[model samples]
Target chain A: MAEAPTNPVALAAESTVATRMSAPPSFDVADFPVPTGREEEWRFTPLERLRGLHDGSAAATAGGSVKAEVTTPEGSGVTVETVSRDDARVGKAGTPVDRVAAQAFSAVEKATVITVPAEAVLTEPVRVSVHGEGGVTFGHTVFRIGAFAEVVLVLDHTGDTVRAANVDFVVGDGAKVTVVSVQDWADTAVHCSQHNALVGRDATFKSVVVTFGGDVVRIHPRVTYAGPGGEAELYGLYFTDGGQHQEHRLLVDHSAPNCRSNVAYKGALQGADAHAVWIGDVVIQAAATGTDTYELNRNLVLTDGARVDSVPNLEIETGEIAGAGHASATGRFEDEQLFYLMARGIPEEEARRLVVRGFFAELIQQIGVPDVEERLIAKLTAELERSIA
Target chain B: MATLEIRDLHVSVEAEGGPTEILRGVDLTVKQGETHAIMGPNGSGKSTLAYSLAGHPKYTVTGGTVTLDGEDVLEMSVDERARAGVFLAMQYPVEVPGVSVSNFLRTSATAVRGEAPKLRTWVKEVKEAMARLEMDPAFAERNVNEGFSGGEKKRHEILQLELLKPKIAILDETDSGLDIDALRIVSEGVNRVRANGESGTLLITHYTRILRYINPDHVHVFAGGRIVESGGPELADKLEAEGYEAYTKGGGVS
Candidate 1:
């Protein structure tokens, strides 16, 4: 099926499916259609790369395949269930009706089901690790937290091998879940991951995604509020150096009353021809009264050749909310603050590091888990050191 | 011995149409362990002298030089001047957000001393100093000068003075915006420093209140950007009774 053109009408329809990103795993194109470049929402994103998956690239073959592991990690409150790969991948033979339809259904058909027990409070996080030593490998992982259960999940994407992977997530009602996903892949790896989360009424969900290094990376995190009084917090930080292209697309929906959502993402891009894009959108329906939503996206362009494109969008059907605001800025370091620090006897480079470290310190401290916080700081500092050279 | 010699110093700031000179040929010398008071009117440029001495990026010094212990203070960078033992207890200290008072003080002390102090000893000393100033020790954990009341910020400035122990300190209007109680605590902190007998102080103020407690040996009246009259501690008492109008009416460019 051909994709719709980018326009207001098609954008409206795409917005609907984009809003339902957190729905249960189902590979039915009729349910969730692939948004075309013609839609205003998909304008800057290169859909052509997504189409690359169909041309025998993302196909799953039984021979010479690689397997990924998902382990429950310490300090993360959830657990993972082991599922067979053959049961998860359902596609066979040649082309299907719709490309999106074939991809979604095929993955959902063979998804490994990890369900959180009701009222179960998990203290250790559920860890997911993916390792591929050969050609590109594609897989889908799904998580469902049972009602009234509280759990913390940590997704660790790792591989000594080079390949591509896709992962998805879903969160349940009256349940509070926190997910911290750290992507520290091999320098030569190509990573393409997608995360979908559905939040139920009075349920709170928080996700933090950090990417250290990747060749060509793309992450799509789609969250939808299914029940009233739901809340979601999303944070992402990515560092791309030496011709790396990292892009993260986020969608947050306020579908019912008393819903709240917040997003804050920061990135530092360095070296020649390195590019990073952060696309964020928030939707407030007419019924989402007393709804509060806010988003902030900041990019630090450290070099002349490096570039960052950021977009913060608000789609409000009616303005009957407590508060709604969006802010975005892409720029270099601040001079006055630097001068103040320099005046205090700190060198220029040390001052820059302090300001940048302080800029992200609040989020680092808020990570709740000490080990994860330390790991993140070490990785981020290593990237900073690379940028200095 | 370390000495801060202000030799025929001339300073000015931008005014209506041209430069309005604040200090005109003002000459003063502060040797180690000596305290001098610069008493003047609100616009008499006492703060200008302190700011100029501290190497504030603003406050142009058109003539003369400031030398500390035989080294040219004017040529030194802000941090360099600081590390060289020149501390300014700013009248309006900046509120640096996202930086805790302890962190900032430790960084400043480390830079000034060129090495980290013993953590246990430093903490104990900081606690003792805070107690002397009647400051809550919790203030040290808070961000530097952020959300502090007028008296609290001033006392914090004194806390830095107690910790850094610079060779020469220029107190610019530290007495202003302070209450009688805060003034007493600040004066006591100054006395403790003087007790060391190894540091010099240049106290700049418009009132004789702090002088009554600090007990400076020399008091000079700054008029039209120059010292029109100089005397002992009695000069501060004289100014308190008579006011600066007499000096303003009689003085010309000197």
Candidate 2:
């Protein structure tokens, strides 16, 4: 209950890490034991459904399963290269903290490094499209932005495959980076990924994760400030249908002075056995003074059989911070909203669609991409039509 | 002419312990072009009659028969009742966040009129109506009742009444929290629709203030969940002078 200490006096405190993470960050995959369904981090996950990605039994059986392509505009001073895992840029942002991420790091055959030089502002977005041809794949990608640079990066996934990937972002001082990762895989696909961001002094980092399809998906994004005055924002949106499991776990480590972090994630679930899990952890260390942070998660359950588990954990070790807070809410379709719409001569089905669309309107606007927004709106309509049918 | 007939209407709402009957064996009739005011005190079930007619799911009809021009109103669903020309201007309109007023009105108009309204004319009509209500053009972009003050909520309800054009309009305490200016504007909106002689107005209120603007053909004193006395427009003045203390003392459905 005691959070957000404002003054810088001698306040007795102890800096700490989240107890949910049983192991510390390490580069070696052997350091982490294979997760069962019982560990704190894996409690809500259906470990058996991860297609052997958790226990290291799954292999790259299908060769052409996933094809990766990166597009950069002409003379943009951006370089994209496919290098071996020994590349100097590999793991520059952060190391793997869990089994799936560590496994991807140790087994990745090649790493893709995209570099945006200092002070170069991009006029067009750098687009990466990962097309799943079939089977299984492992990948690692590093994005390093130079100081005072600005860029909008979009990564899109499609088709069917079993994948485990590690994506790292190294943001330079005073740089502004916006990353949008869309997990729109086929219903038969399985995906587990770890995203790491090392934000520099006075830099701004924003990442938007959207998950719409897949039998199972678990995404872990960790953030650590490298210098003072940095800011990080993590946003996520998911829509879970019947027999699907989607999970997002995030940790924002405010390690430097005057750094700020904000996180928000929203989800809607329908059909029987649909499950959504959101775990947000914010830790303000003892030396990180003047830190301001807040996190929120809201879930709208559309049907009876769907379930949602939302947890917001805030741990402030020092009593000399500026502000810290978190909130989580899970509610069903509001009967009052439904009745209000119905009484306006709108049918039940149309009224439902309107309410659901309105619920996601704010988050969808954050994408800032016209074509992507239009596509999401169309996808939302299609998702609603399934229930109506 | 459209007519709404309510006979032996009994309604109950779920409470802490169990179902508690609110409207007990009430009878009333409202006809097109007629404004009937049902005056009562705090717990006399005035709002119950409005919600029951509007087919709200919260209030259950234990025993009743409601008919609009000889069609069974109770048999229809909420939206069906609206399409059949029944409307209730709720005291506390529900907040629908992110649903802009323009979008809500257009959708409602499309549903009631069975087709989308012509854009140019519809925009003109809405703009003019909002002007008459002294509402700013920017209000159309605000979400429905999301952060509206009391007066704004009442005005929005009346705006819907003007646009939807239901044959049977039930104004439940529409003047409860309005200032004099708002009361006058809302009253004029109701009168404009009434002048068409195509809809009946059932105005339920605890105070006689709004009746001064919108004259009622009949004034009914309600107590014990039923109407105990009926008279002409002068009855409103009489009740306004003496108040409903005499009628509600030992007169409620205890």
Candidate 3:
């Protein structure tokens, strides 16, 4: 097995029109050219809905419209600070992989960094709430978990804003971290964010990304290992309504030996022009022996006019890995499932609700937060009520 | 006691070439507390009768009249029919991937019984019914019929029959895939429901093996979409010795 060089010039030379794998990764926004919807990564996304986030036209303005609130457990040695863009740890976890991400890197005035002290076991989750007041915003947030520290970090986004931001997680050796990022934006908002995680030796990183509201929301989650024995789990759930576009793209780069990764995302869509897309990519470098990974994406179309695109790709340079596989499926509600429920005395409408709820139950349970799970279920029920009417 | 009466029932299903009739003039009567077995070979329209009674959309009633306790059963929707005391245990139960058996049972009970069941008593009753069928308690949390073995599916159908307590229960081919042990267990569940004397049992099957455990009060031989012979339990014994040969000769019951 030969490892393809990851250099920018070499990758550009190997670039082909059929795949996004050749796109070079760079920290500078100019390294990658602006997309024209011809690239595989940008073909499914509507460029106009991005609100100038991709072309570097959306500039930062004064009078910050988005407010932030942070809460941490007492005596946990946790610190939250706004650091300059040139700080030493600004891009330590990940570099900008695309133009928009790189533009976000160069545009944010200040980046927020939340750190947990080594060996600190927090009994409560650290919560970050960001509310927008109708304006264009660019931001960055990083979570640095120390060795052997176990904590849950929640990022809640709301309100209306044309927002593009970068979120990074730097998990220390032997650390356990769970990050839940929720996008419950206003209907008029447009959101695009890139989540990058650098997992350390023997560390565990679990992420749950939930998107429900927003006119156009696109999230890219990427993971790379700092050392061998690292593990990553990514779970996502989204509900797309009439005229909404929601997309999630994920990449797990297994450059370290003995690392494992699992990705599962489920979505439901209804009404005209409702669209959902999920792309899962797992790349195992030649040296990454004993790497095990699997990814799955499933979508349930609840109405006639909705559409979904699910693609799962696995690029393995080494055959010595333990196991690697991927699966993708997009379909409408199973008529037999509905009929089964209705036969048991459940009315037609309620039967549809139960079937949809059950389709998402597995991923929702992975959130591991009771109140969050309950709230999401309530929201799902309300969304389903509209279909009945 | 409730009575289910079907008079000259004509049912058709949409096929590639216009509508194809499946049950042409099926007539029968099932009274509460009685176990009537409808025996027929494959393609004899046995399951169609069960599904039609439950008002499956695929089966259209071109001409028929079905009444349960003097109420028009044919005029109601599928769920309405269930609430109106009609239950059909399909031969191939559908697999519901995410709804747990316990949750499905509770929801169905809530809809049929018109209110939520008391938590304490409902849990106890479910546990008791599972125990009677020799089912593991852990099975209650599993998805309904998803990945269930044939025997397990039959047991689950009977489990519902014992729990829902519908006025009329149509068990379509409940003995098709059951092993001897599962057959005994499922038969016992059916007997318990019949012992209540408030529900009528329409046990549909293709074999007489299950007749050893669940003795039908009356047996009807069905062929070519209609009942050709009806008699006491002795009819089942005769069919066991002699197959549906006497009924299949003329294609419409010789």
Each candidate's DockQ: 0.24, 0.76, 0.76
Interface root mean square deviation of every model, in Å? 2.8, 0.8, 0.8
lDDT of 3 by residue, A169-262 (tens): 8888889988888999998888888898888889999999999889999999988888889999999989998899999989888888999999
Q: Is the docking of candidate 3 incorrect, acceptable, medium or high quality?
A: medium
Full ranking by DockQ = 3, 2, 1
* Residues B135-252 of candidate 1: C-alpha lDDT, one tens digit per residue: 9988998876779998998898888888888899888899999999999999999989988988898899989989879999789998888788888998898899999989888554
Write model 1 residue lDDT over A277-298, tens digit each, in one string. 8888888877779889999888
Alpha carbon lDDT of each predicted model: 0.72, 0.87, 0.87
Stretches of candidate 2 above 4 Å error?
A1-17, A60-64, B249-254
Number of backbone-clashing residue pairs for each candidate, in the order shown: 12, 2, 0
lDDT of 2 by residue, B1-56 (tens): 99999999999999998999999888999999999999998889998888888888
lDDT of 2 by residue, A297-328 (tens): 99999999999999887877788898999999
Per-candidate chain B TM? 0.96, 0.97, 0.98
Cα RMSD over interface residues, candidate 1 = 2.8
